[model samples]
Target chain A: MSRHLPIVAVTPFPAAAAHELKDAQLRANLGRATRTIRDKRARVVAEVPDWEELRERAARTKDEVLDRLPELLARFERAAAAAGASVHHAADAAAANAIVAELVRAQGADRVVKIKSMATQEIGLNEALAEAGITAIETDLAELIVQLADDTPSHILVPAIHYNRSQIREIFAARMPGFSAESDEPAVLAGAAREYLRRTFLSAEVAVCGANFAVAETGSLVIVESEGNGRMCLTLPGTLIAVVGVEKLLPRMADLGDFLRLLPRSSTGERMNPYTSVFTGVTPDDGPRRLHIVLLDNGRTKTAQDPVGRAALRCIRCSACLNVCPVYERTGGHAYGSVYPGPIGAILSPQLTGQDAGANSSLPFASTLCGACYDVCPVKIDIPEILVHLRQTGPKPAAERAAMATLSWVMRDRRRWRGALRAARTGAVPLRALTRRRGGTLRRAPWPVSAWTAHRDAPLPPPESFRDWWRRTHAE
Target chain B: MRIALLVTCLNEALFPRAGMAVVTVLERLGHTVAFPPEQTCCGQLHANTGYAAPARELERHTEAAFAGHDVIVTPSGSCAAHLRAHTELPVYELSELLVDVLGVTDVGARFPHRVTYHPTCHGLRMLRLGDRPQRLLRAVSGLELVDLPEPEQCCGFGGTFALKNPGVSGAMLADKCANAVSTGAEYLAAADNSCLAHIGGGLARRPGAPKPVHYAEILAGTGAAA
Candidate 1:
């Protein structure tokens, strides 16, 4: 709660990015974590007989949900209300944060327990709650480590992925009482965290969690997790508040079977998650007595309206896409500067937030559109298509725009391509001067060409185009 | 068969030898290769850069250029991939034609150097021609093949992206080159000249960077021609 949020005014762009890239320890930590998870996921996925079929089904189901989103939201609201749950609608990030803060105030609670949730992270909800004088304690083990260390989560499933066991031991020793760097084992760390969070779970009057899926027909909120900490957060508090994005809703309860089957297999590579929690509303003796569901729009409606970009909403957050993404493998999650990371994040964040020129703008170009994310996506969001669509909307540098405009003309006419080829062939000798000579590789260039030369060598064109040779031999 | 060589715009103006290599390989296989002069760029640069309207206009010109050809062959895998996915015509990257379409087991080409092959993103992911290029490259005589770490990762020569986000793009390219260097190969070869041009250009500038050769050039045994 109060501990989780800290305001950093500047959006993470060139400055933050350059600094992060320079840290070798962080890079090593992230690389190890992501590779281990990625390899494990691949092995587990290989065992499933109908994995491709399940992916197709999951994709189709998500597409169906997106098509009738408004209707589904209405249905969810009615069913949730009928089950004695009050639903709140948030039009933007600010609205969602304010709604959550107001709910915290209404409960008259100074501290609360929070389950790991990206939607909360996206709106900086914890920071807002802190501003309102309420403390939010992140109960998830990885999230707690991140909060305690005052660091952003680097991976979606593993928030503390950028920290190794030694790093975690150091953070715990500094931040938590009765913790020591000498006790760096997983069991020791888990024991210390369990002891710390136990008090928060019991003492906190209200609990906040994010739903993995919200069923429209039954008003059921579902959470799938490997750790049982989520279960404690959901049941221990007197009041429960769930903040979910509008795109989280699925059309029917039956659809959950495909997703539940697809998600665990694709994500953590488990046939089934260790803990599965589902609730329609506050149960008399089973869980929290008071239930509140905040259905946050936050630019989802605008994304849903896009013919090409809307498909990005189909993500189940299984993070299978992230594991296979090459870009994600190298740059890591923090480089993305969004709660969401990897391929799905590249497409989803831009649409959800309208590609703001800062961090959001850079997201669209983050990937090479390698399509690995699309291939692995259980929901088949066509991540590459949305990436291209968002790239169209994102601002381009002045020189780039002009160059692209000129290239467009060359592409639109056959004569222009031929003419350019002819020009290159005759000037190949002089063009060599444009190249910088190193031992074996070429060196840097001036402006735009320097961009390529900065990293690799520029290829030299031969003396003739294919058309010239064909005409000389075949006379076609 | 009437074969129309779609010498991709990059191959036309920047790497004509790649286009020539495609022709030489096809003709050596006993097919009459024709270059439809009216053919231009695949409009991928425009399409990828977010100028779809003009890209569509280019697409129209391309559709007209090789309208009646029985098959279209290209040295550039990315261009062939773009056409396979975006255009109505049947298109093949030169490597695909050598193996899948032409059924040629041996290319009769030789390259003695240790080489690493990059699975250009468009060919591997977009067009779904998985592992075919590597198979063809392996068939060439005297070629030592090594695995490229993260072979499918993009080299970041995403047309205007290189210019737009120069810093990130540069970082990505550095990683790509580092991976190629890690293989300790004498050369890095790929099917697409557009991506090759970008990577090759960068490798050329490295103090002791191994050269990057196009797949067509390797298959045609023209590594030293330039």
Candidate 2:
């Protein structure tokens, strides 16, 4: 296992979110992109009469895969090897990166093109390849934009969603040699990226990619994308290395049918993505001559062992949760400080790295638990349930734990609860005095309570609680 | 039916009028509501803030407190949802009780004012209390129930979330308040007072904005002139 943890936020989530909230441009860009994508997803999803059923089936299928992950992985490995592909097991990020770097070096290729892969990003493979003196170029438009800008990806599907068209234009002009300065149109920008990467794609001897799904029955790997970059990277290279998370496996090839229908509409809001490249092992005279599959466990087994949190592994990286998340919509993805961001990130990152993984433990507390992410999830992950589960299992601050312990003792008894309530009501007298100037609302509070009043006004506790009123009125 | 009122912790301490409205409306409908003094909170705050043991204790207290009631009704959808999730009780949000159980869309109340309803996230998504509150509001005599733009979006009260992630929560509340204001409604109503507190707090900051009112308060009105 890699002792090196994936990049986690040095600053906690609340502080990071507060910082991200100060940037108006980033928020506007995120708001527009998320709203557009959410609307499109809703429209496309509405077209399917069996969308709910599809979601249920997808959830069930994913559960079954989790239930039999070890067996299915073995099945997949055997089938893939039989199809003339070399299969490698990576216990963690370091092993995966080392394997891929070695593969690239053996091919005598210092430069390799890439498809947009969350798995590769998770393992920091690009940086590892660079350490081995190899240049890995991102081919997907969004990934390419983020790579060129030398920025960390914020959103999963749309890595550079924090940047608007004009910002992207600026990055392209400053970074790409011979790029037009005035063109800000999306098509224009896309054409520039295509021109920039076309030669690299043709001349590259090796490609590093991630698989959206790995079928255990047929030894087939699937890559779904809006742009044709995934197709180019998958086919043009002489040697193909796919870094896949073990959770991305399906029991059979036929299972791909349901996911194919669910993923596109849920993701890019397209009824079908522009490109879906599926390859089995290696082709004799076509496509990549040699294929290598690196199946990574990086804390996946631990997550799968958790009955409540295991559902998080069902995610297909659709970004549906991110689009619908009010917290994400406000703070943008940088606040999450993980390769995964938004609601899914809130659960997935913490579990993948384990809660004690420094600032990553704060991820579970990042959401309002509004359940928007749960409602929009294609696989019915029940993200709120998982979040709460993770919170129970994760680390707790000593003060909070002590407070809860005291509160639990009080709440278990009616007399103690009423006394506590009376004490709280008496304690609020000063707060009430402060709020009297602003129509019985406190604009600011002190210490622990200040977290609330800092942003919105808080209501003063009534002179009499409902219990007091009930006793006074109904005592007779 | 033996109906017990689970006046949520927030409603009990801050907006007691909303709890009173629930009682008045229920009494007017020929039902005697019982106040199980043993009932304190649904433990939503504790549970949501990553304190599961205390939440479970509160849940056990609630389950024991309202153990024998044939039905338990609360004005807050979010609290009722917490109860439904944690306890094996027939807990209902006010609208669900009136419309689904009692089969009365018109609750025989009236408020002559322009009102927009913000479907708090818990009621809309968790309980799926779709159109129940709206149908009741529509039946009220001389009340204009205006449409709130993005009614489905969260008000961002989110229990501890309002405090922990105040910036994002405030941003969400600002958008919600702006949407409520755009409807030109005199009153903004929702099933949950916690949401109203946040939305109302933001509205109060803006001069001449609509005041936040609990839906039960509107339903408890009797064609009275302001």
Candidate 3:
């Protein structure tokens, strides 16, 4: 099952989605929330006249990185090292987690404050740290909400989006000490979280954060955040460890102009993020003394090897695709059962874990290929193209493969195709009584059509096929 | 104009009426329609389901079916889009054939019913069929084209996607149906039959569901066909 690979899909997408579909609360919460975000994104994106151009620029910049990732990574390492930061490379999730854990242990720190970073989540870093008897606290309001409830994030941009205000208040009332909720107001919740985290951030010796974009030339790591909690995590701690994905790199600092404009609009639907922390290295008096940049590859190099799969590495974890995805809106992120979710997750997680890696094999088929994700993508990731590509390469059930083969064989020739149609017509003879009761629709049938009929009805063929009708009427 | 009809496999086997409706609309527009029987399906089902080889094979047969035809038209937007992807053939969805190729928005047909149009995903995103189908629907003589909320959202037909992930598919279908029904339309008309089939099936399960009809059928309805 590749149990240690936290990014691999643990449950088949369909199986997991089926279970989540039954959760009416999750469905309702995600539906309303995603639709709002979708509307906001559209509105804000429309305000920018050069949104498309910005996306192209950002995509081109990321492509440039992919084309010479090795050179760029090496250059980034040299630049960061020159700036007094120690750069470490971890080949896999296990190695990344261990490196981060060892670094944390070396700091002589038992507790570490965190900013919500997909890189850490991808490697199960907090879980690894817990096993080492170290505590990692989530400082972001939404991240804290999910952390307190022991719940995994449902949305990437707004991780605890699945919960309502009342739900958040309840979590705080139960988990947060010296907390009495006056109401389930946004300001009230923020005030409570801020009050609790203020001391934690100041007292913590080490903080773990994630990078939004890293410049190879400047050796700078950027964190684009809305709440500014990540800002606190960047500056307040004595030692800072930024877990960064290898794909999160740009060749030059000039690329940040377009990205800064693209990320907030595509992600939180804001024209500008409140806090953007750029850490170049250790500063003597301003920030942390010891800086550690763990460049985690995990499956990135493997993903970058495939021409079709390499485009997914351009994703900046905006979660815009999630809000726009029909599948994601209904099932939410948890249904993906992976570190990442939604359209990007469906394509990226599978490639990250290899096409044959456990349940991730089914991740590619988790989409309807609606192209909503592609339309909204800030980096112009051809998500549907990758989804289809992965599906073709990934494992298939013997029955489905046989069915496709048989159908292909029959469809290869006109005569056989017609024969199959005639077969289908004759095959429906026994189901005539059922269709009659259902007003000329097949409501229930056998194997292939079984799942289809479980909720939706199937149409019955006419007395004659269209080809037969055409042939009989026109004998030209 | 000699318009070759590639009535998709789904329409050929199950909904031949939709194919006949295409012929009716084209012929009414003073165009000769040829039924190339060799074309069974466009292989959108195969391609979307991960069987690219079979999909390409079907595309070859389809290309051969209408080999020398200048303009190929189909009732289904997705099938037309899928077929258009593989070959350079002038494959046009019915809406595109009418509004763009034939240079006629009104197909001179009517169905006198409260109808809501759904812009299926492929037609909306892939084909960029934006407002072309809806513009044609608006020109129908007696058809009252009602606006559907979130019309661009997918109906969740997605061929085998309905079966492969029935729960999510059913949920999407339910929401789509709710939006269609909310418009209080007698029929939910779309450019694609495959999508209509799914929406129809979902609407069929509901007690007071709106009947699902292809826009071709609505355009083909000349009072008597009603």
Per-prediction interface RMSD in Å: 2.6, 1.4, 1.1
Any runs in candidate 1 off by more than 4 Å, and if so which? A1-16, A356-359, A418-428, A431-441, B182-184, B205-210, B224-226
Give the per-residue lDDT of model 1 (tens digit) for A1-476: 22322111135444445566677787667667767777787788888888888888887878888888889999999999999899999887778888888888898898889999988887888778888898888989999999999877777788887788988999999997666548788998999999888877878899999999999999999998777889998888889999998989988999899888888877887878889998897678878888999998877889889989888888777888877776676567777777787778777777776666346776777666667788777777788778877777777668767877787776666677567666665766665665424433345457656755655555556655556666776663
lDDT of 2 at B20: 80
Q: What is the DockQ for all candidates, taken in turn?
A: 0.57, 0.72, 0.76
lDDT of 1 by residue, B1-226 (tens): 5678887777667667777787778788788877777777777777777767777777778889888888888887677766776789888877677778888858788877788998888888777777777887888889999999977677877766665545656767787888888888888888787777777766654555667788778888897553
lDDT of 3: 0.87
Query: At residue A162, what lDDT does model 1 achieve?
Result: 76
| Model 2 pairs whose backbones collide | none
Mind sharing the TM-score for model 2? 0.97
lDDT of 3 by residue, A291-346 (tens): 99999998899899999889999999999999999999999998888879899988
User: For each candidate, what TM-score against the reference?
Assistant: 0.93, 0.97, 0.97
Give candidate 1's TM-score.
Answer: 0.93
- Total clashing pairs in model 2: 0
Candidates arranged by lDDT, highest first: 2, 3, 1
**Considering TM-score, which of the candidate structures 1 and 3 is the better prediction for this target?**
3
